[model samples]
Target chain A: MNTNSDYPKRICSTTGFPICRSAEFFVKANAVLGVVFLLIGGIAAILIALTRWQAVHLLPVDWFYRILTLHGINMLIFWILFFEVAILYFVSTTLLKVRLASRLTAWISLVMMFVGAVMVDVTILLGKADVMLSSYLPLLAHPAFYLGIILVAVGTLIAVGNYFATLYIAKKEKTYEGSVPLVVFGATAAAIIAVVTLLHGAVVMVPTFLYSLHLCPQPDPQWYRLLWWGLGHMSQQVNVCAMVAVWYLLAAITTGAKPLNEAVCRSAFVLYILFINLASAHHLLVDPGVSAGWKIWNTSYAMYLAVLASMMHGFTVPASVEVAMRGKGYVRGLFGWLTNAPWRNPGFSAFFLSLLIFGFIGGITGVTLGTQQINIIAHNTLRIPGHFHATVVGGTTLAFMGLTYYVVPLLWRREYILKPLCRLQPYLFGIGILIMSFGMSFAGSMGVSRRSWDIDAGGSIYGPTAHLFLALVGIGGTVAFIALFLYVGLTVGTLLFGRRIAAGKSMEDWGTPKVLSTSPGHDHVAPAPGFAGGATVAEAHPTQGTMVLAVIFLLSFAVYYFANWKALADVWPVR
Target chain B: MNQESSSGLECPKPGWFQAPSGNERTWIGMAVIWCLILSVMMPYWHFRGKQNSTGEAYRVKPADFVKRVEAFVKVNTGEESLVEDGIAPVVPAPPGEVYLLAKQFFWFPVLKLRSGETYRLHISSADVQHGFSLLPMNMNFQIVPGYDHVLTIKPQAPGTYHIVCNEFCGIGHQQMVGKIIVE
Candidate 1:
């Protein structure tokens, strides 16, 4: 039952609460890195948005394309990856009430990832590659770009290994009892996907890298396309899982409420695990080479189940929110509780707005565009980015920001800096994102293509309508940039300079209580009296090595599938 | 006068003079408003009309056009001096099927009709990459560019439907418009 011993020794000195040095260090390190990534990505998003504005036509064609490519990748890929890594760290340690299994491995992973990210940006800046982020095959990039990506994938693999090791150690030491907590389970699933996805990245990129250096002939486009999807689709699923996990985490932190029905939450995660992979074919719906029947089966029919799962969660989470608010005695219409809810609370506000924005734009467009009839019109257009921003920025990024407000302070044992600003940041960013998404959708409807260098060339296909929409998009980008800057400033300041708060006082004492402790042996663990849930601590925690190994095996399968299929055409014949 | 007096004598029964309850009146008002709105929007449903084409509908077929193109190509190629004339030389459509070329921004079609009609026209790109939109008037279909999208326009109207690429090719994308005149 002495979970405290597993955590670093916390001396209750002048601080009036136990402060674990290791927890504090990890929390602070994550905050700093989170801020840096947010700043870079936010600036890039703003620049891209502003270019759409009327005032800035100054950049030349090639320069503009390069900048836009960097901006898109940075905001979409880099920002999300940075936040997910930090979340992985937090979920493994804080949620499970255990320290990281290996600090050295974690640090090494961070350094390697940082190096890889920098190399990519530098290569992009040097104009060595402008594959426009998607980098579809036949279009090649500089060797540095591929190498950078490989390093990043390897770094993530290492981090996943460390997380699994920590979980194994926790089970060995017997931290808790019975079924893994929902949030941890979801994170573990995401990490499993991440490993599989990254391994695919290695498989695809290693050959591509060699080919670029003339050590091998170019890989066939069809082969590259299929292999890339393994990475692309699976990484997206990781985001999906992580986003959902944050939703549950936020609910616990904000209202001191767990999912009203645990089965629903678990079922949603299960649905994602089973159905998300097949849904990746939606991206290939308009592609010429794929068969009509295969597209229908993989993209359309397969996606419907995942869509249903999302809708289920969409309804369930809000219903839980409503119930929690209703319990607080806001007796009004179904929507009245929303109006009466505390807007000042950053966690509540961000979670609420992010959920709304993502579901309406991201979720709707995703479903519509995934359909065969619609994908023909929407693919490779501005619509693609519009759909993703709705999901990634509005969904995952917002959730990460909201979570940081709690986790940073909780881990660091410091009060949030600029409390008012923290509350304002989410709304500003959320509104800005909504505006940007709307503009992009309008442009797409007008048939504005994505990844274009010059939309207004002499013989260009786009007309005045495209120009107008791009301008509006620029305005939205500017607003988002400012909001993100504010967020980074607030988050970083809170971690380092915010007024310190007492530690023993749970997150609720600061404002609202969002976390739940179901793990036994911890003092704050949820109690189930009279032996119904009681068990020996050792029996409570099961070794997680099997789960970890299972994930690694899945990754290996994906890698082998890609490599073998590319090398030998007949190895995995199409039916 | 008697009728008026009889009607009025029922004491103009001040029908529940109290103002209607807010909730009840609101519900009634909402219902009326919804009904009115639905009625106005209903007419749009039939705007496309009922002139539906069934799968069994008779229309022009591709085989007839192929024969016409082959005859033209054979006759034109036989006379070597025909190519030297100032008149535009006629080229045959490929042996088996229709061949349309879609380039950086243009759709070019070579058409030969069953009635010994030969028409060759140039489709140029206006803005970005656009598909040559070929739709049979009164038929339920469209053909996009970049793929081998061929159609036997019967020259029914002997006019153009204006081929525009649905894909957003670039800035002039909207302006990249082409016309198909079948004669």
Candidate 2:
């Protein structure tokens, strides 16, 4: 298999992973297109942010809605899913030491996805599909819009099929010994979720598309929402799984981290695969036609097991990092490992910041807002976007950016052009997103609507405080867009003009930290394989700093969750 | 734990399963408890909390819902001066049934009610789906075109509450605001 010319595999000079040429091409192709869509979406973000800022009110009403539609699809679906497809390819072939199952399938899927994306963008820009991302039924969009989405979903499904095929081949041919790596396991979780999400897309979109063409009766809007969010919100869960995988991969790359306990980590991923799709219920919490029992049961994901999974991942990810850093002899205090972490490495900084923002802000607000009663205060407001921007943009996008910092030199064989700017990119993006999300949440708390072109357009004025928060949205969005521009520009420029790595030479280091001990066994204290049956007590080097942080996170979650309930209580008495 | 090769890229040794220990174990325990608490809160709120989306709704056509809303407005209207938005009627009603219709561009009828009295508000969209986002209070609910969503509400504060169409219904979604006056 290694010597087979048809597959044509090469060893990654830096990471030493096997990178099949066909798989590598697909990864690069998807990533490049992903960045292209990100550019489109980023442009839309600044424009929409300016318009939402009453002081600017940049675009007219129609264009505002139109560009807003484009932004949602491009950012949420195109940018994220395209990159995820790339990740699926990378994890399957690269991590598992196998060739892509079929290059023809990969190419066909990419082409379909590309064409579909273009069609959707054209339909939105032409004002044929002013229906926002959800494309909720009864608010019909052009038939082309539905068809475009169908194409993308089908293409993604094919790509996922290819991923599975590769995985099966890896196992059948004995490409590597034992079970797949933890990162590959996580990617498998994401792929499984994507399959469910895309199937939901088909179930909901096909009928809606037919209805748009006047071939079928209008699908019930309630039913549309119920199924559509299975695609919409469940798709975001795919992003969560992928982002966590990237967190692990980046941690390993940057800090030489390994999973503290493979069983715990793998079990967490299993929870995601089993229960994360139930999270789509959160979107339909306040909607009519869904009963309280149904909403409560689904929204909690059966005793919040999915959330417990997230908390476990959140702990294990950084705990892995803390242990790894401590192994490198940064164990001065409970906080020394964190303080001495590789802040200069954009990969480390971006990964760490994404974890913080996602857990503290996104995860907290999401759980609170998804509470059946609390949705009354949050549904269809800026708070909804506020929560997602932290999760999708801050968490997923930032982590992907961190991966690219290593991926470029490793895959594209090009060094990053601007070193200082590369270092600053994550902080810029993270702070911008933080400010923007906070502004959105606060402004939404004051009843600033999500998709409203003007809050006072109907002659009902939101006070100065709401307007001030809107200003924060504009300011933060501008900064984030600038950072996005910087990242895209650096990536593009590096590919075109940055110094190329000599063939067969190890890639240049991206500022990894110096370790006190060159040895591995002493610092990374774990029960050896011989005692795997029962040596739980033998695992030493406690992640005390991470524990402190976890407690802080839990405390923050409580404060925010309780505060939202209190706010809900203060609202008009309703049943 | 499983041993790794020098490259750190290979799969772990075959039997890699192990229980979480030390801080990891503690965090998992605490997180599980928190999740349980979170799960308990929603149903608890349904039983005891003031605000709960009972999801009391029935299937209805857009036209039927519109006709019902108009009939409610006509029966409740007492003063001509209450009509402030040209076509929109400001209907003051006693504690009982009330109707509010959400369309592409506006919420029909300016609803007026007394504070400290409960009203069964029947909300439905006349055309596409719109959000029934009662402002200042920040309470929101979905208004599907073919459903009569009933919210039994009692206003505690005396003020004019704005109903902003938070859902993207159409081009004029921002201009789609209705008023609820509690006196």
CA displacement after TM-score superposition, residue A289 of candidate 2 (Å): 1.5
Interface RMSD of each: 24.1, 2.7
Q: Per-residue alpha-carbon lDDT of model 1 for A1-575, expressed as tens digits?
A: 64546467454332233443664465456546656766776766665666555447645556666776677666655666666777777666655556678778878887887788789889988998766665654557899988887887788788789889878866776654444566887788788878878877888889999988989997755457667777876787788788888887776557643343444455667777776777657666544345545655566435356655565556546655554454454435435446666677888888877787777778767765664434544556677788888898888888888887877666666778767778888999888888888878778666565555444442444557767778777777677778888888776787679887675554433355333333443323222232221011112222122123223433443353233223222111111
Using lDDT as the measure, the top candidate is 2
Residue-level error in angstroms, candidate 2, position A348: 0.8
Q: At residue B154, give the lDDT of candidate 2.
A: 93
Decoy 1 TM-score against native:
0.71
Best by DockQ: 2
* TM-scores of the models, in the order given: 0.71, 0.96
State each model's CA lDDT, in order: 0.57, 0.88
Docking class of 2: medium
